[model samples]
Target: MPDNSRYSAHIGYLFNELPLESRIAAARAAGFSAIEHPAPYAVPAADMAALLREAGLPYVQFGLRSGDASRGEKGIAIFPDRRDEFRANLAEGLDYAEAVGVRMLHAMAGVLPAAEWRPEHRACYLENLGLAAEEAGKRGIRIIVEAMSPGAVPDYFLPTAASAREAIAEAGHANLGLLLDVFHTVAAGDDPVQAIHDSGETIAHVHIADHPGRHEPGSGRIDFAAVRSALDAIGYAGFIGCEYVPAGVTADGLGWLPRRA
Candidate 1:
């Protein structure tokens, strides 16, 4: 049965082969009230909203695309040169968030340029983050910067919860929070529970995938029970995203979790 009143599982791009409406409907069929993954921008907001409402699902939070801005490539937020472009993309992303009535924004700060390892690169990232904070604050959107594993996202400015925490701290803003993913946490060598505890006030959106291969919870080595306890202890109340690569059908792989209805 499906638990009508419980935690929502965030489906990812792994299930994109299905039409967006079907995907949202299937998530509802499987008993989750929300969805996540790459920004669902291709589908018009009104249309997306209609499907979600019909299925009784909430359009909780989604990603910010990171690609080329110059020559059509458009990311690497916080770099000195990309600041203006990044802000434009941020504003654009915020507009999508508003359309869905989302309270939090899941952001990929793009990769830091190769020079970010240099002395001057540090200042550039901090200054740019300040602007991002200001912009997100204006829209009442909580922007969480994600940190991926080195193997996953090599040059990105935020590559671990620790680094994300430090950078957000340095930027010194309340709206800026950490978008922690368990798979990346394991890849980045972080204690998943401790990372959330460490982030304290800044841990916003969470993406949950088990490790070894980004499979659905319980399909990989992560102890979801422990992780769930950690979130419960912290009084965290946000979508625990299932941003995993499907081993089979996405729902079949994740249906192991307990459901109420």
Candidate 2:
């Protein structure tokens, strides 16, 4: 097992084949101190809270409800016409974060309409994120902005770590920060270590998936040891979320987990 203290099971990907409650138990059994989910809005807050308590696991992170995935809306944060919808989602996200005792909330940036950047869209995103950051600050939750890869989420507005950092800065809120996913960094043809070095303290959370396949850590070309070294170099203390699809059985792919010496 990985050192439960340093790692979090992203149940959304790890035990995705199982039901929610079962996944919670599976994380506990696998020795994870915490777990994250993509969205838990379908589950009642009380029920989700009870399950986490039962497993002695802390809820580390959860994402805001991006608009319809089937309809190709990756997020509403950057959609100028969806300002009201984004506000409603933010309120729901804050409430859910409080109920689940989670400290971080990922605010996904929606896909670009023309597969290119738009000034108005960036403006709308900053406004929406600033509002969410204030609300999140009140609830002791940090708002995370993640950079999506073009291949996985084509036309995504924030497609690079630098862009994410810029958005967070322009939002001008203490609670706004970056969700640095190493897989996305490498997939974008950038060095994951340099992204880590650049992100530094603004990194509120980290996600792990190997490049070329988006599979478990050891199943692809990423050198997680170097990633670990960079994280330590930057004094990052947040949970390292194992957010990868397994090539086979999930449990069978956990050998790359960092066990404490």
Candidate 3:
């Protein structure tokens, strides 16, 4: 647990594995005041709202499901073949975002192209975002895209800050923005903090964790204190999400953070 009050946890991959309500309970017990994850479309929206209220956690953020990369499916907005599906997903996401008080909706490149970056691929991605931005604007949710771990997702699109910046620029929509991930930055061999600073103006949300293990902030090879310092320097006022696995009990490894914060 981060002792700092400034920290929040993205009940990331874990939320999908547990009973949603139990996950919410775990988040609050771990000292997280806010929680973000994919909406439980499979679980009823009313049940999710009840869980959020009962757990006393007020925050939620999530991206719509992107299919497996192994299947060669690119994000609908990014690949021509998937455009219709992508737009439909966005509509569903917007409805849930509204019902659940989700403030951020990451336009995560759910799946990647089979090859490396392409001008054609980039065009599709930007075009898709342009349409989705209109939907996001109406719902009051920002559609920020995220970069995944480079090696973990090499063929996937949107792995670097530069590419995402370009895509957003071409899209030219205010509602379209960037989501920064520290674990992916380290995986890409870029200074996550510096990237954040350079992309600060365009940044909408930040995902933080230590690497090479993607563990909680203090337990990995990456210097999280430095990352936190860089974020502070950049005047980044967005939530710093604890998106890592715990070495022990999630609360045991994290309880110190809330006290210190």
Candidate 4:
């Protein structure tokens, strides 16, 4: 086990071979004080909440309903014609967050064809985000937008933390912020340190995976030490979400987790 005070297990990537309850137990065993997931809509919210309480873990964050990935739809927020779909998903996500005591909701900007980046799309995105932020704010929850790397998700509307910041500003909601994924920043050819420094307090959450392989932090070219230093410089006191794909057993791949005690 390690001193995982600033770490949270993204169960979608860690111990994903197990069910939710088993994943929670594994995260606790591995010394994580909090947990997050991609989607938990399959299980009842009460059941998920009970599992977290039993494991003594707080729910840090979770993503809103991105449309079916198999159909090439990453999310609905920015799709001009999917306003109703986005609203439905937003309601569901907010309900789930309230039920599970999640404090942050990552509202993924949908992937669109390059030709379809029209004014309507942008307007729809900001409008939907504004509404989502207001609704989440009422419950003391924050709504965060993450930038997906274009290399991994081609034509993703949001492709860099800089762009996310601009969008958050346009949305004009105090509860809106950014979720800076270091892997995506590298993939977008942006310096992670600079991104963190520039994003500053707008970064309410973070996700980490190495650039070259999207694996454990130390398994690739990313200089996590430098990244940590930049985060420290910015006075970031949030969890560093472990969202990398494990090379083998998830636990065996956690060599980068600090063993403070």
Query: TM-score for each prediction?
Result: 0.88, 0.95, 0.89, 0.96
TM-score of 4: 0.96
lDDT of 2 by residue, 29-91 (tens): 876778999889989999999999999889998989999988998888887888999989989
User: Each candidate: what lDDT?
Assistant: 0.71, 0.87, 0.72, 0.89
Q: Quote the positional error of residue 35 for candidate 3 in Å.
A: 0.6
> In lDDT terms, how accurate is model 3?
0.72
lDDT by residue for model 1 over 107-160, one digit each (tens)?
556555566366556677677677767887898877777787886666666778
2 versus 4: better lDDT goes to: 4
Identify the superior model by TM-score, candidate 1 or candidate 3.
3
- Model 4: how far residue 211 lies from native, Å: 1.7
- Give stretches of model 4 more than 4 Å off: 1-3
Q: How would you encode candidate 3's per-residue C-alpha lDDT over 166-208 as one tens digit per residue? A: 7788899998878888888888888876887788778877777
Best by TM-score: 4
Candidate 4 local lDDT, 1-261, one digit each (tens)? 123798999999899878767899899888777899978899899999999889988989998999997888778898777888888998999999999999999888888877868998889999999999999999989998999899988999998889999999988889998999999999999999999999999999889999798998888899888998988888888988888899999888866676536
Summing lDDT over every window of 10 consecutive residues in candidate 1, give the lowest-scoring window. Answer: 1-10
- Name the lDDT of candidate 1: 0.71
Model 4: lowest-lDDT 10 consecutive positions: 252-261
Among the numbered candidates, top lDDT falls to 4
Per-candidate count of clashing residue pairs (backbone under 3 Å): 9, 0, 13, 0
